[model samples]
Target: MTLPAPARFGIMTAPSQVDYADLLRVWREADTVPGIEHAWLFDHLLPIYGDPRGVTYEGWTLLAALAAHTRRLRLGVMVTSNRFRPPAVLAKIAATVDVVSGGRLDFGIGAGSRPDVPMARREYEAHGLPYHDGAHAVSALAEACAVIRRLWTEPEPFDFTGEHIRLAGAFGNPKPVQRPHPPVLVGGRASATLRVAAEHADVWNYPGDDVADAVRRGALLDRHCADLGRDPASITRSLVLPVSYDDPAPVRETIRRATAAGFRHLVLMLPAPYPEGVARWLADEIIGERPV
Candidate 1:
């Protein structure tokens, strides 16, 4: 009935190959469950799984709709691809979501997916979105974090000149409801991305299933933090684990392992077609039952 100290839980439902009605139902149900403190969606323009032409909702747009529909669960794109939109434009989009969600936005971002991942690459090519190399992507992502934060917090319009980003008189009107901006979550395990997280992220998210690898990456982040004179503990370590409907044992064990491993922010990713009362099941089964 009690969660381990400092552990926070949430859910992620990717918008690809999933119907809006189903996604809405899950979010609405999750909003009432106290065990789940936050929710997330991934960003991708095209279907990366299932049918190549399956319907895919834009993360921000779908997120805004979910924000309006849910009264509580903190929400955001798991990691908005930095290459998808200009930094200033993404800032405005995020600010609007924060306002809509009444300040429950956790701004998660990362460098775009690598060109080697065909699913990711095809989407870029299909949409005419350029896929940059790792170095360029990481550098641009760093500049993006800086520029976006300034847009959210700066009082007046200002010009910016960075190696990867430049803006003239860029300003955000009707600032986000969260003062000094929403919590910034940078997601990735790459060393360069970790360096960016050390400098800018309030929370750093590690993708995939390998817990030990994530811990190793976290150590790398700690080193990066040291180099920047930032306390390693200042950044929350987050990781995602997949949920299984047929067997809750593996998921529960993963949760236990992850929490014990010092991953305080745990996001349980639910595979769809989400079963009936899935959120309630998650609370009762996957996560320990709520306190009596």
Candidate 2:
């Protein structure tokens, strides 16, 4: 199937269970490939899979290093966890990356790990961070999103007193290179999150393989947008799917289904121990002549 207009193709190299050299290699290769328009890293304080003690590089730090090394690929953490750091501080980190990359920054964020998911839940406890209920999380996420935008664009020092977040004379210097701030990409599937996306996101990503589910969640987002008197089309739909090294057929089929479902931002997830020239191989095989 032909990709729709304004479609994009990018790679996500989850920044865990791998070394910096390996990630840099794939990103540098992707930098020169036109089919690959963006690159991503994931935020996790500990390895969520395999051994808990496996090597895991911090997302923003690694992103900064990778940004300095690569020349072209638009880059960011796939979806930064709002619970991991205060929103204002995160804004600063993201802006610095935008400067480092010469404005090639996509700010992706989410409401952090779900308390119901044990794998994600343990990361919070293990790191001595508080784990809040879903209600609290969703509300705080909204506030954090607002705070982040203010930190990125407000001209002078300001204060905020949201129920979940409070600030005093907060301000940002050396603002992001993107005039209004880098494009905000919010990732989540819940109805509450979709509402936040309707109000704040330039892109909304569904991180699963369920095409039917994506369509359903997308409809929910459309309703949310309508309720807010906003255009649903304003938020670009994104899908995050894993890449099969030995078989591109299944991935290709998923891509077709997702595009037909109105998802244009495809984030092809690459597993660890990346092979030589995998980026070029992706261009020739999976993304061949897609007009992205």
Candidate 3:
């Protein structure tokens, strides 16, 4: 395949690791770039890699602030943990933020997963949240998606009953500006996750460092869509990967291979303490070359 035209690019940053001042500066600078379509924040209570107790701003709080600060760029958490809040609450927050941003929100969510670290487990226990794993976690996430969709589209209050969530006469007011709801980007590569994506997501995102993985996952998603009697073309494919600014060759190659693999949306995960002018340079080099 020759890949689709006009690939969309986005930036993902860790708000907890980056200073608020620098985060604001980067958002402002990125807004001026023409080809950057969305700005994403990771959903983590603490740093995932190093210094587990590091300072980190809440994802929703930062998103709300960013909504007020930027005018053109769309904003969202790369993938909010489903366990962080109740589905109804998450729906309301997303609705309000979409309104605040004048309809620029892409709601990405996933089954919460934890790294093999003691602190990661402790954080979950400290917050009084169950840390589900394997199929159970994915099933819970599916139920969450169902609740969120109902809250977004259902006009009359109705009871929602699920294995993991239950609501009676629930209603979500001031629905998001986007019809039906904001674009839901489901993230994960597991079979259950792909099945959920096929059934519910407008976009499916996978995190990996290789294009081959994207290609394999894309095929798997197609199979899932087929099983559900859904059109595979209805779902947009997206890839999330880390890119270094010092080496433009590798970044370019990744983009090229990803495009070939049918990924139209490429979210570049920028390292903490982002290098100055790197975002602008990327916009100029990659996005500027693509036809509008």
Please tell me which predicted candidate would have the highest lDDT against the true structure. 1
**Candidates ranked, most accurate by TM-score first:** 2, 1, 3
Which runs in model 2 stand beyond 4 Å of their true positions? 1-6
- Model 2: pairs clashing at backbone N, Cα or C within 3 Å: none
lDDT score of residue 282 within candidate 3: 69
Worst 10 residues of 2 by lDDT: 1-10
The per-candidate count of clashes, in order, stands at 0, 0, 0
The superposed Cα distance between candidate 1 and the true structure at residue 126, in angstroms, equals 1.2
Where is model 3 more than 4 Å wrong at Cα? 1-3, 115-119
What is the C-alpha lDDT profile of model 2 across 202-286, one tens digit per residue? 9998877788999999999999999999999889999988999999899998888888778899999999889899999999999
- The models' CA-based lDDT, in order, is 0.92, 0.90, 0.85
lDDT of 2 at 231: 92
